[model samples]
Target: MVSLAAALASLAVGKASAEDWAGADAETGQIADIAGLVRLAARFPDSGSVALRLLNAQLAAGEMTAALQKIVVLYSRGYRLSAASEERLLDMADADQAAWLGSLFGRERQSIEASTVFATIPANALLVESLAQDPQSGALYATSVVSHDLFVSVGGGEWRALGLRDAAALTGIVRDPRNGMIWVSSGDPGLGSEPLPGFRGLIGYNPAKGAIVRRIAAPEGSNPSDLAIAPDGTLYVSDGLAGVIYRAAPGAESLEVAVPVGTFRSPQGLAVVRGGKRLYVCDYRYGLAWVDVPSGKVNRLSGPGLQYLDGIDGLWLHGDALIAVQNGNRPMRIVRLVLSSDGKSIESARVLEQANPAWTEPLGGTLVGDQLLYIGNGQWNRFGEGGAPDPDNPPGPTQIRALPLGK
Candidate 1:
């Protein structure tokens, strides 16, 4: 008797061949070979042309159970079938299969409101992470995670690509409102390529000229993740791997360690508080911490029942509240945390958006006017082992959604 583990293992690595379906008709044989078909489907979930044929075979043999399960898993893995493939699936699906699919992907079927969705323009790159609104022109700019390009869009306009030179892994962006120069954090060399003497800090870009004006390098062997600009134009960057925060002036030639190592675990997002006297930093998994600018003393901020602060990627300060895009949480959500009078601790927090339909690896966002414009669907999971988006299962259009501020 085959054990369940062995059966699953066999299915995982098994290969299906033409001889396996020789006896049965093309239709019946495909569905009859359930285990083999599933194995093929699993290996090629992104291949719409492949998955659609398998689904048809399963339908031909009345194998709805296996087909249903495969469909759900493929969708979860970021598979969007072609129009013809989708029509076939819908036409062949039974009431039960249709109901299950509807319940699972109902949110995606509906159109997101234009007001809430700032833009639905397609970008040249995928896996977009950080967003910054041009306060002067009302244009929104975004940086790609896996691609080395920046995108800008006017109010409901098309997204124009601005290529970056020698910079990969662009993570965060913030426009210096004082001078309109954009500050972007990038690990241009990419992971494992570090230790090669290269720039590993911020890229100062002139939006008007659409060119990089300056490249500020961080300490040797550092990967900067998120960035925050102080009221006085001081830049605060979190080095997730180095476990330190680096500080630099806008036009400074070099970066100096601001918060020494071991201050926080995997620090990501940062927000400089009012008066520029202190800074709030999210340690990714260690909740939130504040550092006194005068002393550089880092202290954790706790609230009632403060247990975990895992998965906080984008942190923004609005008035006295801290808006956090907590994608690490199961189902993911956007939270509004009100700080105490002293700005020392979180008094309370409320869910602004929870179990949201638009969330797909929510990353960074910025406050624009009265709305919080964020990357709604990053589609980071669409990348295959080769680090490129799978052509067979192409992602849908990227969306920049706006959530009302103070909500």
Candidate 2:
């Protein structure tokens, strides 16, 4: 994370625009401006440095509720506060707030209970984004953000690689139960750039034979973030940079917009209804969005009794509830959102896990029976100052854990 002073310096010199604050915050230094920084942090939840500065300002101002919220948000974003800073904040808090801060930021949750380590992805494929597993055989499939290979393991066995070297930054993967084939999405390395030559949108791999079956490319320059395969084999891809969801029917010539553009702000994970008639999308800027498949209409899910609902990266439909991996909020965690009768608004949210020691940067996952198998630590924060992977400081093995739902 960039220092607050340097981030403010960019704004002072006009080196960064209002649209590029996320990038500007990482460039360096420290400064003050509590209200403005807090508002900016709320707007761009992904900017860890902005949130950090807000925490500093809140501590100085003796704002208890606001400070706790920033602490939780920073913790959720995987940002650890400095010992001096934490002590200063604690000095200003009451006993109750102190205890809450200790529990919220401490590693005590690491001892609450341990989720089973389903598999350990190789160090070479350290940045795993999403997971998909076969129900019958319990074989797990994982995608890598830095490598073109897909990692697969069966029944807690050793992981094997399925090469898709032609693709870059593989984001999401899913299995078709009917054919037992795995479909994965890959596009440009990051959201800002164009796709390299010969990029594929959604590629199908025959796991049984360990060979590529087919490749479906999305519209030009589209960076597919996450995908959900319907019961009838229709594929839905969320373009994070474009803020549009594209749908492709089975054996279709190409991909097309399922919902109109501007329907979301950086839509990430997606979950499809069994009939392929509806979808639940995670909008990074906005909250959750419910998409009507047939009408191409989208509605944001919001009302009373719902808070900390934004910053969701992975979403899964589990019976009547929607399980979400919310990495973009104050306390990075997994939540079970109970939907209303109309399937539009959230009645309530139950946290499955939060402040777990294993969460370095949680992204996506797959469901295996009663368990939600997900990447516990994606290590997205390991990147260097230049916004590139630092080879000299490599991220170690990727950890996969199963959050049992007791279904």
Best by TM-score: 2
Which stretches in model 1 have alpha-carbon errors above 4 Å? 1-115, 188-198, 391-393
lDDT (10s digit) by residue, model 2, range 1-407? 33333332333211111121121122222346786775665454444545666776777787777777656645543445666767877777788777766665465322223366767888877578899988888788888876666888888888888777587678888888889989888776462244454465888888778788878878887877698989999989888777778888998757888865645657788998877888888776555777777876666564232345567889999988889888876557787887777677667667788777766767789887677888888877766543356788778888888888753
Query: Which RMSD does model 2 reach against the true structure?
Result: 9.3
Which digits, one per residue and each the tens of the lDDT, describe model 1 over residues 1-407?
A: 22323323443321111111111112322343556766654432223334555666777788776676555544543344445666666677676555555554544632223227767757456767888888778888888766667788877577887887877577888888788988888763243333323357789889898899988887767888788999889999988766778999756988889987655556789999868899988766445677888987766665433223446889999988988887765446677888888888777777677656666666787997667888888776776653467788776677778888654
lDDT (Cα, 0-100) at 323 in candidate 2: 90
In model 1, state the lDDT of residue 298. Answer: 66
Model 2 alpha-carbon drift over 4 Å, by segment: 1-114, 191-198, 303-306, 384-392
RMSD of 1: 14.9
TM-score of 1: 0.68
Q: CA lDDT, every prediction?
A: 0.68, 0.71
lDDT of 2 at 385: 41
